[model samples]
Target: MIKIALVHHINFNHLSLSFKQRTDYIEKYLEKILDAIIVKTNISICTEDLLLLKVWNPKVYRRLINHPKVNFLFSTHNHAIPLIYPETFTEQMLLGSKVILDLINPKKIQGVGYPSEVDFPPKISFESICKVWEGIILGESRIKISGLEKDEFSPVFTINDAWSKNKIRGHLSRRAFNYRDYLHKYFRDEANSGEMLLGIQDDYKKYAQGSVLLARIDLEVILFNAPIVDGIQQEPPINKFRDLQKYLINHNVDFLKVADLDKTDYKIPEYRISDIAPCSSENIKWNNKSLKRRVENIKFDRSNKLKYGIWLSLQCSDYYCTNFQDLCFSYGDKNKKTIFITKTRIYRDQESGIKLKLLQGKTLDQIKMNDNELEKYMQYFMKSNELLTNYL
Candidate 1:
């Protein structure tokens, strides 16, 4: 039996359900999936406990390194070394600017402000620039520009109805530093290809901030280090469809939207330069056209009742920590503060951990004497977690 160790982001506890509830739910799911595989193979199957970690907490890793069964670590947050973030830029280079062209955009240049530079089609328009700028701030990479094309290699981009020059400009840049350092060794063969890294654009490029450039360099390390695991692959190769499936299967990880996968999976570049037209201004104007729709289509033929509701912690806090803040609100009472406490536990200073001044006097143990108090607390907590699902 393959021993699998699942690593969770710190955000897991911050999810809607109580820590016990979430763990129980995941435990059952893992058993079911493995049970099927075992029945078919008729082999003894053993499962290791899933190891959850606070991705941002250095202490967690310190403990993780000591775990005996720990192997195949995965993360939703940035932790790989060499931070991977996004960068977006407006112009390829300034006059006489010292340029380090990715092989794909290999044009020898002396410095940032040189006027003798060869001119090509306006590589970026003002509208596109603005879009990418917004994308950088939002940590979302959604636009790209086409660069030199090659007949031997299949075009890396395709046109989509949702394309918008303005939206394209709003794209963000992703820098995955850990992956970059690891991937570069394998990419050395192509070191001389003179091919611009398929796509490398960042709004951060405009600022020339050392931090942003460092992020870009880290991203290159990620690209260079990516280990296309034999069968593991990112799907849709676009909107994170594949990444979500992988996380769901391996991590028992919870996510509400496909976009959330961006938070769950290891880094993947966000720019799609080959499909510049969809992100162009003219196309962005017709975002709803038959050819350019961006949002997914949903069908509602049946009644909608949520089975689970998701709760998001507006701020980060640790369990039983006095400094924690209660971010969720109680129903019918804007001023009333609430903290989600499971019915099984009783505490005097529940509010002391994650104080919600509004919930100043409320306590699950104190409220337990009230009729239906547990259900009320669970439902309210579930609503905040956004875990309730509705099926018609």
Candidate 2:
């Protein structure tokens, strides 16, 4: 049985939805895509056979691509950035995963590796949008994977005839997989049969613009499949966990930690977490480096504090929240700091019974969060003395 890993970034483009609403839409939409699988292949893919993960950084995403246990790697991001490849762990697993890299616009480029030859389609449809994703699996398994053989350069394209007869930008299978066989199998079945489950990011619309939506979708795909309980759990930013809880409940899915999933049967359990989680490459490296150098870096200090809402960036526009700038720059005045808390989002910290809360509730408009808010959130960091290790 091949295990598919659908990694995606989250972005809110289609709907004027809240974090919870947006997640519901994406999870359902992606689930529909997975349900469409059997139409293209006879393979029976269970929700348990697929894993979802959310990566905050490109480094973690890149590593997931090379993970051996990941039979197939699908990313919905726009630009492909190079980062720390989790090559070691994947190689050790030796799962022979296939990699899928998605490009929003393929016709505009000359070729897969070079410039394109065709003009960009005037109007792209969701049904025919060009998403360049690669996969690393065996020949038979290749057909089971949708668009597995499709690349940026292909003679035949799959466009919605109802909408337009426009050609798809990506190429069809070029190597081990035969295009004829793939098509025969794909068209032979009118409908697909499989358990469908959608994965979405509960708090994504607030932070994403249309330009970055695709990148966010890439992370969302990963998170949707990732087992969350064993995923990286950092301190101070309890809002993340709160958001995660909301995601599970809103989707009508049960939540289980990574440890729990490992013990459960292969049959799809309500929900499961992954033992090997992905993290930001830069953040992990910064944490791994020596502490002395981190303190010397002012930017790292600010970022560390920003994570907890203690300090804000001077580079931040004035239109955003100004609290962080005021408090961090206050120099020695401790009285200038104020505790800002969220009333709605409250989660019990398993490690500490103390309730974790969001610092700000207002939707983050084009304007950024107040600097003061950052300073207020960092109180936990300052008290714990763990901020020093977060520096570069």
> Which structure among the candidates has the greatest lDDT?
1
Candidate 2 local lDDT, residue 262: 20
Query: What is candidate 2's lDDT per residue for 1-392, written digit by digit as tens?
Result: 11111122232211112233333433343332333222111111111011112212223333333332222222211111112112122221121111121211222111121000111111222222323312111111112223233332211222332334322222222233222222222222211111121212211122111101111012222222211122331122223323433433455443321112122122221111111122232222112122122312334223443333222111111111112221111111333322222112111011011111222222223224334423322332233223222321
The lDDT of each candidate is 0.23, 0.22
Misplaced by over 4 Å in model 2 are 1-20, 26-29, 40-392
State the weakest 10-residue window (summed lDDT) of model 2.
Answer: 40-49
lDDT of 2 at 159: 32
- Cα lDDT tens digits for candidate 1, 1-392: 01111111222332233434333323332222222221101110000011122222224333433332222111111111001111111222110011112111222211111110001113343343333222111111223344322212111112222345343212122333222332242232222112212111222232212121111121112111222233231111111212323433443222121111223222333344344422232222111121111111222222322211111111112222232233332222342322232322122123112222213333344443232433333334434223212111
The C-alpha local distance difference test score for the whole of candidate 2 amounts to 0.22
TM-scores of all models?
0.19, 0.19
Once fitted onto the true fold, the runs of candidate 1 whose alpha carbons sit more than 4 angstroms away are: 1-144, 148-171, 175-381, 385-392
Worst 10 residues of 1 by lDDT: 39-48
